[model samples]
Target: MALLDELAAREAAMRWLDERTQLGTQTVTQPDVANFPFNGQTVALLLRQQGICKPRQLDAALSIRTTWTPPGGKPPYEDVEGPDGLVRYAYRGTDPDFPDNRALRRAFEHQLPLVWFVAVAQGVYLAQYPVYVVGDEPENLRVALALGNQQRWLGVPGPDEVDRRRTVERLTKLRLHQPVFRAQVLGAYERSCAMCRLKHVELLDAAHIIPDGKERGTPIVPNGLSLCSIHHRAFDANVLGVRPDYKIAVRRDILEEIDGPMLKHGLQAMDGVSLTLPKQRAQHPDRERVKERYEEFLAVG
Candidate 1:
């Protein structure tokens, strides 16, 4: 019945999460979270019923979570990024003085890091760690969290203001939208590659049909494809492409090249093969975007 000290528990929990998360390729299931080893006892890494979790055993807040929002629904907490590139997390409840909110405030004051569990599906989460509370806005009853220490170098927002703004946008897209995009895409396609049907979740990625940097490249399910690492790289490099009709196309040079079995079976064989889409019709890739990309693929070759 021994409990781990505050720092020990946070560190241990992060190590446990790292084992499960696979550097953003994989997700942590509720079962894994529930069975977290704390000292000699098993403790849940996240709160099951609430978004903000601060178990009595720990002095500061342990984790904050946002559960799966049904299609067309909004998340309980709107974690928006400010102009400074920091992600703002809302207070636990409407009340500004909730104990959980207080715990999170304490973590910010002490410079302690906390885990943020973003749900990809029911009972499944993508864990982002070492999240520091860099800004506390009591007027809004929310705290701003930063994933990178770039804020230290940027400093006080003066001469480099435009550069700072651009940096903020880029950081927001990468740190927040990227992970959620990957999670949603992978989840939509049932964690299998659309081109090859590969089932290694840890080796799979969410490939954007429309590049995320483009104005039209929204991080939504229809604009993404679940792909294995190899396929994702190939797609990005224009070595392979998918037509609007859902057929795959490997670049002519690649198909004709004499290479290892990986080329023959992996890329060439997938040519002209129709994409295996998600079971749910709503999760299917957008045909118009697919066509636009396919036209690029054609012109490049």
Candidate 2:
């Protein structure tokens, strides 16, 4: 009799879900039956089926609990209430679980769409946010999840392009600032400065090929060049430049100057040299991005 009652309950649950489900075009994936705490995991799977596949392209961060948790037993990722009557997600410091967060951060850096699914007693509510990793504070690394204003985009049926564009810009401005972005870019360059081949982890930075504010700029490894702090600054300030052909160039005025060993070897010696590229050709600096930034450097010089 107990077995029959359990079966009946499962049937009722499936029927309730099926009525509200927006089934995937390719396959109708059903929920897991045997697993305990099935609802939250089930909602996550349904979200995956509802077009959040390809971690490199699209993703969703899910939480069965109302708040997100951080690593090292830190406080839960916070929700800051706004005057606009919406709650925004925020996290600070290194997520000790960074490896697990790679896919989600990759999606954010590329301006790829992502959703958040939280399982509630009634069902699941899907939310979208313009995710960003703001630079660190004295206490911790800061990340923000502003409401993306993407109703239809997150599978909520609505229309508002103005808000969508604004949200996108807000998220795109800090591609280089995120820990995940740094991890990926540094990983691609083998944790060495691409220009100087500096191997010290503390000295290296994930330098963007183009400034983050530019339309074409992104945190993708192909758009990044691992550079040490000084060289990274030089690259950004147009003191050093990289051509699309993978050759390096120091500003002509700086190169011609007679200076001490530091200036001579540090900057001028690298002039007309080839960059140390990633082993994978795909991870090599994007030629178009190099061309764009190189042109800007030439214009400034």
Instruction: Give the TM-scores of the predictions, in the order they appear.
Output: 0.87, 0.47
- How much is the lDDT of residue 234 in candidate 1? 95
Tell me the spans in candidate 1 whose CA falls farther than 4 Å from its real position.
1-4, 23-25, 41-44, 148-160, 252-262
CA lDDT of every candidate:
0.81, 0.52
Instruction: List candidate 2 stretches off by more than 4 Å.
Output: 1-177
Measured by TM-score, how close is model 2 to the native structure? 0.47
Backbone clashes, each candidate: 0, 1
Q: With candidate 1 superimposed using the best TM-score fit, by how many Å does residue 243's alpha carbon deviate from the native?
A: 1.5
Query: Model 1 Cα displacement at 127 (Å)?
Result: 0.7
State the lDDT of candidate 2 residue by residue for 1-301, as single tens digits. Answer: 1334333333343444334333100111224211122334322323323222222111322221122222223434554432222233333225623543443344344433333332211232322222222211223322233333332233211245456444444433332124445655776677798888989877888788877767977666788888999899999899999998999989989988998997998899999889999887877898989999999889988
Error of 2 at 69 (Å): 23
TM-score for candidate 1, please give it: 0.87
